[model samples]
Target: MDSNNTNVKSNADTILIVDDHPSNLQVLFALLESYGFRVLAVQNGENALKIANSILPDLILLDILMPGIDGFEVCRLLKAKSETQHIPVIFLTALSETVNKVKGFEMGGIDYVTKPIEHRELLARIQTHLTLKKMSFSLACQNEKLQQEVYARTRVERQQALVGKITEKIRDSLDETQILQTVTEELVKVLNTDSCQIELYDEKLTMATVVYEYIKEDSKEAPREHLRYHGKVRQVIEPIYQQLLKKIPLQFVSTSLDSKYTKLACPIFENGGSKGILGNLWLLKPSEAVFEELEVQLVQQVASQCAIAIRQARLYEASQQQVKELEKLNRLKDDFLKTISHELRSPMSSMQLAMQTLEKLLQSDYPHYKSPKFARVLEIFTSSARRHNRLIENLLMLCYLDVKSEVFTSELINLQIFIPEIIQSFSARIQQQQQHLLIDLPEHLPLLSSHAASLEHIVVELLTNACKYTGPGETIGLQARVTDQAIELSVTNSGVVIPEKEQHRIFDQFYRIPDNDPWQHGGTGLGLTLVKKMVEVIGASLELESYKGQTKFTIKLPNHHCTLS
Candidate 1:
C-alpha cells in the first residue's frame, strides 16, 4: 500500500522487533517496511527468541525491560545459540541510565536506543546497526574464503614437497618396480589410507591394469601378473593419470567424503601428464580444521612427493625401453637382410637363366612360331616367368603393408562379384590339377564398409595359399557372410592340415612349415603374412581354421565403420 512495500525485495535484510507494546510494533513494522527491510514483530522475549531462530532475521531490536524473559536474557540466549548468535541485537527502552546501557552491552546487545523515539532517530539507529551487521557478515565470509584458499595452497605445497623428496629417491635409485611399490606403501603409511595401488593404463586409456599389485586384503603382495578392469571406474580415473602423464596435478577426493567408501584413487601428476596414481586404502577424510597449519602442510608435501616419483619412474622406463627396442631392431634387421638376400637370389638366378635362353632362341629363330611343338615350349617358358613374377609381387606387397603404410580407403562394395570372378580366373589352373573350386558368396547385400584392393588381395592370397597346400583333385571353397558387426569371408581347402604349433605362427612373414615331403609346397614363405597385412589394412581381421582334412583362412571385417561415397 506504501512506497516501502513497493521496494520490498526477497533479498531485503530481515529484522525482528521485540517489545511488549502493541502500538510500538505496529509503528516500527510500517517504518521498517518503508525503508525496504523485512520486519517480524514479537510482543515478548520468549516469542522473540523463538521467531529469531526460526526466521533467522539479519538483525534484532530488543526492549531491555520486559515482562517475563526480558530483553537482556533473550539477547543472551540468542548470542549463545550456534545458529542465531550471528544476529545483531540492539536494545530499545525508556531507561537512559548509563547502568542500563552498560548492562545491555554486557548482555550481548550490539547497540542501544531510547524509547518514545523520534521517527528520524529511530530510523537512523536502525540504519546504523544494519550497516554494522552487514559489515560483520562480509568480514566473516571473507575470512572463511581466505582460510579455504590458505588450506588449498598448503595442500598443494605439501604435495610438492612430497614430490621433491620422492624425485630425489627416484633419480638416485635404480629399481623402478620397488620405487612404484614403495609409493603405494608411503601413501598408506603417510596418508593413512586403507588400501592403495599404482595401476597402469592401457594404450587406449579406457582400461586400468593393476601392475604387479592385487587388492587382496590378507596377502598384501604385489601380483606377478597384470590385473585389469574397465568401465565407469576407468572413465573417471584414467583422465587423472593422463593428467599425471603430462606432469599436471589431477588430485581427487582430498577430504573425508570417501572415508567410509571402499575404493579411493588419488592420482599423482607431473608436467601436465599423468604418470600414475597414489593409491590408498582405509583413508579417512581430512579433519575440517585440517588447515591447522601442520596438517595442511603435511598433506600438500605428501601429494608433491608422490607426483614427482611417478614422473621419474615413467621417464626411466621410457629411456630404458628405447635402448632395448633399438637393440632388438638391430637383431631383426640383421636376420631379415640375410633371409631376403637368400630368398631373392634363388628367383633372380632362375629367371635370369630362363630369360637368357629365350633371348638366344628368339634371335636365332623365325619370329612367328608356326609349329605346335614350339608353341608348347613357349607356354612352359611363359608359365615359369609368371610364377616367378607372382612370387616377387607378393613379397613386395607384404613388405609395403607390413612396414610402409597403414591407412585404408573405406567403402562398401560387392564381395560376390569379386569373389566369383577371382574363382573363375583360377578355374583353369584348378582344372589342370583336377581340383574342385567352391563359391558361396550371396548376391547383392548391404554395402559392407571396407577397402576393395586390400580385400581382393587378401582373397587372392588365401586362394593362392589353398592352391599351394591342397593336392590335385582336392576342393577349394570360398565363402562369405555377415556376422554381428563384422563380415566374415573364408577360403577353405581340403588336405594339408596345419599343425597346432605352426598354426599360431602361420601369419608370420616368411615362416614356412619345414618339410622334405613333395606334398608340401614351398615359396618365399610370406603368403599368409601378406594376407594378414591386407586384411588388417581393410579394417578386417584374419584367422585360420585347420584340422585333419580341412583348412580355412577366415577374415573378419568390421562392418559398423562402413560409409558410402
Candidate 2:
C-alpha cells in the first residue's frame, strides 16, 4: 500500500490525470507540473485506476466523455470507495447545460470547467479547486481528529466503569471457581461477548483448566472444544508465557488468531509479580477493535486479580493437606496407646500363673518311684516361666524403640562358635520327634559385635517355632550367613505350612494362626512378636515368609555400634 510514496524527500502532494487525447493530456500535465505539483499521467482509465491505487495521488484530473469506463462511471466508482473518495476530482469537458452539470454532480465531480482551451481561465479554476481541496482536506482532518478524541475519552470512561465493576465482583469471590465465574459473568455483561472463559496455571506451570465459561445467547449447540480460546491459542502464546514465567506481563493484540476470531491476551500482574495470561477476550469477526490500548490496561487489571485469587486457592489446598496429616497422627496416637496396654497386661498374667504352679510343686512330697516324671513336669513348668519373663522383656525393648532410644548389651561373638552349640541344646527335642536338623553355619565366619544373648534368642525362637509346628518326620533347617549390610539368619521348616495372607500380620502382638490340628500344637502367640521386638531392641532387622508348604523366618543382625553418654 505504501509502494508509491516515491523516495518522499519532502512533504509534497501528487496529482494524477487520465485522458485519451494526447495533446490535451500533455498540455495539462505540463501546466500542473509547472505549478510545483507532482504529476502522474496515464493514457486511459485503466492505467489511471492502476496508478491511482499505486500512488494514491492527492488529486485527479479526470476527463469525462472518454472510451471504456467514462468519466461519469470512473467518478462514481472512485466515490464508492472511502480510500479514493477523498482524492478531489475535476472533470474537463465542453458540455454546457444545467442537466449536464447535475449529471456531473451525480457522478461525484467535485468541479467541472468548460473547455475552449483558455489557458488563463483553465489554470485559474484548476488552481482554485486545488487550493480549496487542500483547505477542505485540512478541515476534514481536524474534524476527524476531534471525533477521535471524543471516542477515545468515551472508551476510557467505559473501560474504567467495566474494569471497576468486574474488579469488585472478582474481589468478592474467595475461591478459584467463584472468582472465575464472577469474572466471566461480568465480562459477558460488559464486553457483550460469547464463549468466554478463564484458564489458570498450576504450580508446575502446566495448563490447569478453564475455570469459567460464558457462551453466546440463543445457542443450543455445545461450544467446540478446539475452537475455544484456551485450547487453540497455546502454541501462538508460548513466547507470551515465557515472559510471564519470569514475572513480567505483556499485551498482545492481533486480528488474525488462527483463521478464526481476532483475539487479545492481556497478561495479569500484581504488586511486583505476574502469573499467566489473563485475557483470552476475543471477537469472531475480523476487527481492529480487539486490541485497543485502553482494552489492554483494562484486561491487565483483570489478569492481576485472577493471579492473586488462583495463588490464594493453591495455598488453601495446601493447608487442607496439612490438616489431613495432623488427623492421621491423632489416629496413630490412639492405636499406640491401645497396643501398649495389651503388651503389658498379657505377659503379667502368664508369669503369675507359672509362679503359682511351680510353688505348689516345691511344697509337695513325691514318692521315689514317681520322682523322675514329676521332675520332667517341673522342667516343662520352669521353661514356661522363662518364656513369660522373655515376653515382658520384649515389650520393654519395644517401648524404648518407640521413643527413639534403644539400649542393647554388646559383645564380640562368632556365628561359627555360637550357632552349632545352640542347635546342640535342641538335640534332645530333635531326636524325640525323630526330625532331621540341617545346620548351615560355616567355620571361619566374621566375628559379630552385638549382644550374643539376643542373637541367640532370635535364632532359637525361629528354630523352636519350626520344631513345634512341623510333623515328626519333617526336617527343620537353620542357616546363618553374613550378607552385605547385616548378618542374615534364616530357619526353614517343612510339614506345617502357614497361610500366605497371615504371614504379614503374624508379628503383631497376640496374632495367632488357626492350627489345622489344634490338639497338636499350642502357643501364647508371643514368640514371633517377641522375636520382632527383640531384633528391634538390638538394632537388627527381620522378615518372614510362608509359602508352598514351608514357613521361613529371617533375622538380619545389623553391624551397629550403640554408644552411651
Candidate 3:
C-alpha cells in the first residue's frame, strides 16, 4: 500500500478500507487521513474481515469487486457476527448501473460511491456515515445508563420493604432474644449470606457472647467454622468492638472467615443516655458471592432497631429486681416493729400498775401523803411515765401504717362534740402554759367519717404541738367549720414559725425540725409523721403553713358521708 504517515488532527475514529487495487487504497487512505481520521487500509477482502473484527472500527469502506469474498459478502459476514455488527458500511463500485447499486444497499451497505471516485464526494459520504455512527453510539449509551438507574431504584425499594418488616418485628415485642433472632434470619435472606451472628458485650466490655446465630443448612462451611468463640477468630472481632466503644460505625473485609468465605460486621447501638454500641450484626458469605452496598446499609438500619429492643428489655429487668428488693426490706421492717412493740407494752403496763399501787398506799397509810415535798416527787414520776407510754404507742401506730397492716374502719363522729373532748384532755397542760387558748367552735360542724382512735391521735398531736410551740401569753386557737367541699379543722399558734426548707421533711418518721432541740420540745419526733399517716388512712389531707410569726396545721376531711348518728 502507498503510505504517507503525516500528523492529522486525531479524532481517533478508525475507518477500515478494503479494495483489490492498491492505487484505490492509497488515494482513499490519503484523502481520509488528512481529515483527522485514523485510517486502516487492506488491499483484499480477507484482510478486511480480520482487521474489522480485531479493531472493530467506527466505519468500513469496501470495494464491491474483490478476489475471495466480494464487498457485499464482507458486509454480510460483519452483520452476522455479534462483535462487529454495529459498524456502519459503505460500498465502492465503478458500475453506474442502478441494479448493482441496489444490490449493495440490500446487503446492509449503509451507502455507496461510484469508483474512479470523486475525492470530495467520497469524503462527504464518509463524513455523513461517521456522524450517523456517533449519534447511534451516543443513543445506545444513554439507554444503558437509564436501565442501570431503574435497576438501582428497584433495589432500594426492596431494601426499604425489608426495613419495614424489621420495624414491625420491633413494634411487636421488646423481648431481646426474639428481636435478635428475627434480625439474623432477615439478614441471611436479604444479604443471601451463608450465616449470621449477633454478638453482645457486657457493660464492663470484658466479655462478649454470641446472643444469636444462624447458618444456612445448604452451606458447605461447618457451623463451628463460623463461630467466634474459638482461637484467632475472636481477635478479628476485637478491633470492631473497639470501634464500637468509641461509637463509630465501621465495616472491613474480615480474615476470620475461611479463604472461601467473606464476612462483614456493623455495630449495634444502645438507646438511652450513654449510647454505646451494644454489639455487632455479623454477616458471612461464600467468597465468590457478592454483597452490594445497598445490602450492607439495610443491615445497619435493622441493627439500630435491635439495639433499642435490647436496651429496653435490660432496663425493665433491672427495675423489676429493684422493686422486689424494696418489698422484701419493707416486710422485714414491719415484722421487727410489731415484735418490739408487743415486748415494750408488757413492761410499760407493769410500771403503770406499780405507780398506781404506790399512790394508793400513800393516800391511805403513808405518813408523806399529806406532805408537799412527797407530793411533788410523785407528780414528776407520774408525768415522766405517762410521756414514755405515749411514745411507745406512737411507735406501734407508725409500724401498722408503714406496711398497710392496719385495716381502718370509718365511723361517724360529730366534730362539735369531738373537738371539745380532745381539748379537755389537754386541760392541765393548757392551764400550766398560761397561753391564751381560743376556741372558735361551730355548733353544726360536719360529722367526719374516720377511724375514731386514729382521729383522736391526730387531733391530740396537733393540739400538743400548738400548746408547746406557743410562748406564755401567746394565742393558741382551735377552729372547726364546714366548707362546700369538705370539713375543715385547723389549730394555730402565734409564737413559733417553722422554716420553709424543714417543712418538707417534717412528716418523715423521727425527723424533727433542725434546732427544735429534743430537750426543749420533749417530743419523740414521731408525732407529726404518725399524724400524717393516720390522716392518709382515713382519706384526709394535712397541710401546714408557717409565715410572719404564725403557724397553722389544717386537716380537710373528705366529703364521703357516713351515718349521721
TM-score of each: 0.41, 0.42, 0.74
Q: How do the residues 9-87 of candidate 2 rate in per-residue lDDT, one tens digit apiece?
A: 3455677878788888888777766666677777677777878776788878788878887888888888888788877
Ranking by lDDT: 3, 2, 1
State candidate 1's TM-score: 0.41
Q: How does each model score on lDDT?
A: 0.68, 0.69, 0.79
What tens digits encode model 3's per-residue C-alpha lDDT throughout 1-565?
A: 4233657444467888898898888888888887778888998888899899888989988999888898889988999999998899988899899998888878888999887799889888888988888898899899999989999999899889998887787756657778777888878876778778888776777666677787766565455544443112243345556776665555545555445556677778743446867877778776666567887788877878788787787787788899999999977887787788788888888888888889888888885655788778888788777877888888787776745525667777887788888888887877887878889987656567777887888889999888767777788888886766777789998978889988898898877766653236577788998888888887889989999989999988866744344
Question: Model 2 — which ten-residue stretch has the worst lDDT?
Answer: 278-287
**TM match of model 3 to true structure:** 0.74
C-alpha RMSD of candidate 1: 19.7
Superior by TM-score: candidate 1 or candidate 2? 2
> Could you tell me which 10 consecutive residues in candidate 3 have the lowest summed lDDT?
228-237
- Top-lDDT candidate index: 3
Deviation from native of the Cα of residue 131 in model 2, angstroms:
27
